[model samples]
Target: MNDSKLECLLIRIDNFSINRTEILLCIHFEISTQTMLSQSNLNLPGITQNVSKVLTIYTGGTIGMTLNENGVLAPVPGQFEPRIREDMNFHDPTYLPQEPEWLVLPSLGDEKRVLYKIKEYDPLLDSSNMERSDWKRIAQDINDEYKNYDGFVVLHGTDTLAFTSSALSFMLQNLGKPVMVTGSQIPIYQTRSDGKDNFVASLIVAGTYDIPEVCVVFNHKLLRGNRTVKVNCEALDAFNSPNYPPLATMGVSINLNEIYINRPPLIEPFSVQLSMDANVSLLRITPGMTLNQISGALSASVRGVVLQSFGAGNIPSNRDDLLTELKAAIARGVIIVNCTQCLGGSVADAYDASSEIFEMGVIFLGDITMEAAYTKLSYVLSKHAWSLQDKKDMMKTSLRGELTVKSAKLNTANRLGNVIVMEKILIQNSSVVNSAIEEAISFDQTKVIELLLKHGAQLTRPPLEVAESLCAAAARGSVKRLQSYQTAGVDLSLPDSSGRTALHMAALHNSVDVVKFLLNHVDDINQRDILGLTPLEYALRNQSTEVIMILNQAAKS
Candidate 1:
């Protein structure tokens, strides 16, 4: 091809207004060129081989919005694609060859080159206006192009991004490829915009990783779609998952939490269910909330209600009207799920204040985010074939990893045996062991310690003396055992023999959960050990990136 003809081909390839049919032809040309190059003996330098194609579905969000003549930011139809194509950050000048026949991105690490095409929606939507129909459209698009692309990206607005993400997670059943939902707090047209970074990172993650579930990518964090919530409207870091940890954190490199990413079922064919019941309501209870207010929320037409109740799902125990209203709602075939209003905690029936609500058949949401509860309830209720009881059962069961199962009750007989062993050990060495109970507690043998206390084992030692056991439990990464020790009145600030606190031990062992628990209970995070190393230093020494993040956040808090 002559220079002018080659330039025309490059311009056509870079044109974002072209339809999907034209993009497919460009892809075919690249494939044909690869075949011809392989058949001949010629080898091309700096040209990436084995490209991975990703489908970028621009559904309109803050990432694509620009300032109009009125100076208010709004979604400008047909603008996002062309902007990305012309941006230097996205289309590196070094990667654009003299011939410019194909568009290719730099390899993620040393993996296959990522090639992508944009499919913009006819009319862009602000995320606040996103509904079930829009979610179904996005899901259907992915389903139609499932086998043709390695992964997919959905550009969305941050306002209702979590809802869309959660809806898609349920809609895309048996998915075996990454589907990333991302948007920016600022428009890509702005000088200080976060759109380019979030967009590029989501593309790399979708094209590189084999994560087989819907996810939200924002502020350099990859979170499960159903678990995510929009926590901030103004900050750059806008979304968070309170109950669940992030699946990955992007820094100098993309650090993936492989253990948390869900794997697809073997031999299952991909499918999409676009239907969702829109009659669900989320009622957040406040101080002086009235029965009439609650009753109005659970109206006859509402199919499901996600009640964001007080701590541990407590309602107005003094108000019989509230209990009556909840019972009546359940009787009328309305599913009421009790989720905690607190940022982190589970809704349990352990408290007397919550007993009446539980007795009225209010289902415990068990540390699930409000986003997950609302979306899951809608998804479950959409099945017309399911009975009322079936819908309730599905809400309690985790279809995705949205909620965690409560821990099993401890075995009583085994506890008795452990208590006996501990009692003998305490009796055998009463004088030499200054704090036998403390030693037992440090090892996280809570059952033995509990039994010893029941049998009148002495716990008369000073609180500081029990610090060794706290450190031991932290090292073991036992949140429950650590809580038991904390409840037994151990001084969280006391240092062990080596002058290391529980925080240090948790950080050194890379126990992120334990470290988070200690941060709330511990007196000082900067307290150094014998070597003058704080918890942050220990985290760095052990190369625990997650622990380091926890400590840094705790320090800021």
Candidate 2:
């Protein structure tokens, strides 16, 4: 049988609801044709012949749980695979990729194809019972199958999903493929379940994008694993990244924020670290806590401790016993890392209450989540080759974009030019006027516009003359400048003198990012310009492959 004939057979089976035996027979049959499958027939224009293969590691989670004999939801072994195989959405004959072949997504206009397999773990575990050994097993599994698949997905429980993701980010050094960890608040057996959507989105992202980081996908947002936290217990939107923005968002279309994603070094080889020290402890300080309570947490067996301090890494300076116990632990070679109790601020030594702890050799963790700090401490302590100071130094550095160093303010004057500076001087020296806002838009200074707005400058539509300049920014491929104007409340649908919107200008210049942004915000993408040309026509005329793909998807939606 040939590829086309096999596709035809699958389509017939799908339309008629044929027997499983026939589908199995067709899957087992060998193809002996030299005729290649063309991209046009598959509706994918730029994809290659090789299909992307994703390996899903299903470690017992709420996503696979079903009602057991006791009449309560539980992780039942050997049930998840059967459920997926029986569901039409997941196992439809037409949707199934030709054996070792590609399966196109109908919702995406058949632009991308994915081939995936599942590997379920034995003796399923609740997330609360997960330990360091389980993390080591998951890491080794990925390392063993690194060369066989394009990406990986781990279906995990929501409770410790963030910890597992953070552990994998450090364990899998120089990772080259996407490793997405996701699960659901509800089980798959229920009528109203989120598992199906979360799992399907994760598979698509893993197969298509080159994120190359440990990420958690939930409720349509893809977040970096190390930066994620379980924010809710009952809501479907369980995870959130408070300090960092999501790497991508899944909606009517997958919008990738490429600027924030961390790209690995191209020349480095992927490796896994299996040894993790489990001798770490975390302490959360409360008011009027006894010294014995604090000292007991730092037992002799513990090598590292993550101190959840009060407000900006502060300990009670008035209480000498608390400071003495911390200093005693440091003297005994215990590595104490200071993390903030708040959800979203960086730790600093500015407060007098926090100065004593800094003086006693407590390392500051800036904006590092508690989950990340705990796992990172264990990871670094397991490196027996590095010295004590080296381990402490690595804690402060950003391994896997977990932390960021405080830096000086940006030189806004140099980047924004003299027009912005003059506008600022005018605003600070006198009352705000409409001409300043117009000048800011003319000079492409978004910051100046924001400043004017902050100082009581009324946001009115720019005059007809500056509308041409708005389109000019789009043509120049300045997404940052365009975003500034959008932030300043400029109407996105305003037409230029030539009747061209920003989308038309972006399409003409082949500005892929700008085109995507405009498409997301523009009300009518099919609106024709004065020349009767839509953005799609402009993209087609310029042969902009990326722009055409985005616009085509938008048109389909």
Against the true structure, whose TM-score is highest? 2
For candidate 1, the 10 contiguous residues with the lowest summed lDDT are 407-416
lDDT (Cα, 0-100) at 531 in candidate 1:
41
Question: Which pairs in model 1 have colliding backbones?
Answer: 442-469
Per model, how many backbone clashes are there? 1, 0
- Model 2, 55-122: lDDT tens digits are 88999989999878998878988888767766766553355434423333333445455666788888
RMSD value for candidate 2:
14.8
Per-model root-mean-square deviation over C-alphas: 18.4, 14.8
TM-score of candidate 1 relative to the true fold: 0.65
> How would you encode candidate 1's per-residue C-alpha lDDT over 246-295 as one tens digit per residue?
99999998898754666531224578887899999988888788767888
